[model samples]
Target: MRTTNFDFSPLFRSSIGFDRMLNALEAASRAETMDDWPPYNIAKTSDDDYRITMAVAGFSQDELDLTQNQNMLIVSGQKANAEDGEYLHHGIGGQAFQRRFELADHVKIMGASLVNGLLTIDLKRELPEEMKPHRIAISTDSALPESETKRIDTANQAA
Candidate 1:
């Protein structure tokens, strides 16, 4: 693996609470080529709904594993049995595979299903009440009872 370094000090001067984004960018810069096996597709079914479809032929539900940890999703598959025989042409790929996905905040896996050599995983982003945006109403002096506003009396203070 090759090592690469980047200076993000200039960006930090005007940005706040963006350290994680910078770190993610640096990590992506150093990441190597991803494996092409077990090709998958990610789609946005709705505003907050997502789906990940992976083609895992010759793998049963029991042979496949799916797990989520923090902000990461992992999917792996292994064949239960392997036949040692000479074949003229081997078409379908039955080798073991492990794939990872980086999930965003507030995203959760709804469910998963396997059918017809395809493994589909459903995901949804459900924001918490505290995280959702709220509208703030502005107030005017006429809308409130008349009350004397506090003032700093400079004359009453000692020099």
Candidate 2:
């Protein structure tokens, strides 16, 4: 078996708090094979907003489960037992499956809906007020007194 190794050093240099995302990517690369059952689609609706849609044809809302734990979003489904008649050929897939998604910091699950056999999950990134960048007002020489201006000049000179 071929093992793929991912180098996340360069990504770590530019990103501040994305260790889990990079680690998740590396872990995904190391996975032996990709599971395509119950296919899903991830789309960015707008800046800081995302959506994940999966084709869960036979599973209802009660049979499906959605859980958000820290940085992980898990979606699983298990079909309830149903009366089986004589089937010529069962093509529709309803096997139990679980899918895990790695979410970035500040990304929250806004809502989820199951419609037309498609399960859609909405996510939005809401940065805290402290985390958002704010302009720092500069003290001009005219705004401050002589003593304060002198301190500002001294600080600038020292820098």
Candidate 3:
């Protein structure tokens, strides 16, 4: 197995508070090299909405499990025991498997459903009002000395 070397020194020096984010990125990179069973797709349906679709062909809703802990989402499936009947050919994959996904801050699972051998999970990012950017009003008026040009001078000229 090939090893990866990443230098986060620059990020640490420049940023103030992003240790969790950097750690998550490193973990994700490591996980990318793992198995790819039960093919999945992550799609951004909208700006704050996302969908994760996984092909769980031989697994039913009762055989699957979904849970969320902090910023991690885990999905696993296990096939039930089979009867004494022998199969001439077993093409479909019914082996047990587990998959995990790291979610960003403020991202939460909306719902999940299994239909037609496909499992779809919906996610939404809801940022708090304090975290959203706000427009700052700029003071364009320049400060001038009161004695230099007083309002009395303008009033006298008008009179």
As for candidate 2, its clashing pairs are none
Per-residue lDDT tens digits of candidate 3, residues 1-159?
787868776897788889898887766566656678889999999999999999999898999999999998999999999764888988888889999998999999999999999999999999999999999976543655556655546656853
Clash count for candidate 3 is 0
lDDT tens readout by residue for model 2, 47-126: 99999999999899999999999989999999998969988998999889999888888999999999999999999999
lDDT of each: 0.90, 0.91, 0.89
Compared with the true structure, model 3 gives a TM-score of: 0.77
Clashing residue pair totals per candidate (backbone < 3 A)? 0, 0, 0
lDDT of 1 at 155: 91
Candidate order by lDDT, highest to lowest? 2, 1, 3
lDDT assessment of candidate 1:
0.90
* Residue 149, model 3, lDDT: 52
Candidate 2 segments exceeding 4 Å error: 1-3, 7-18, 145-159
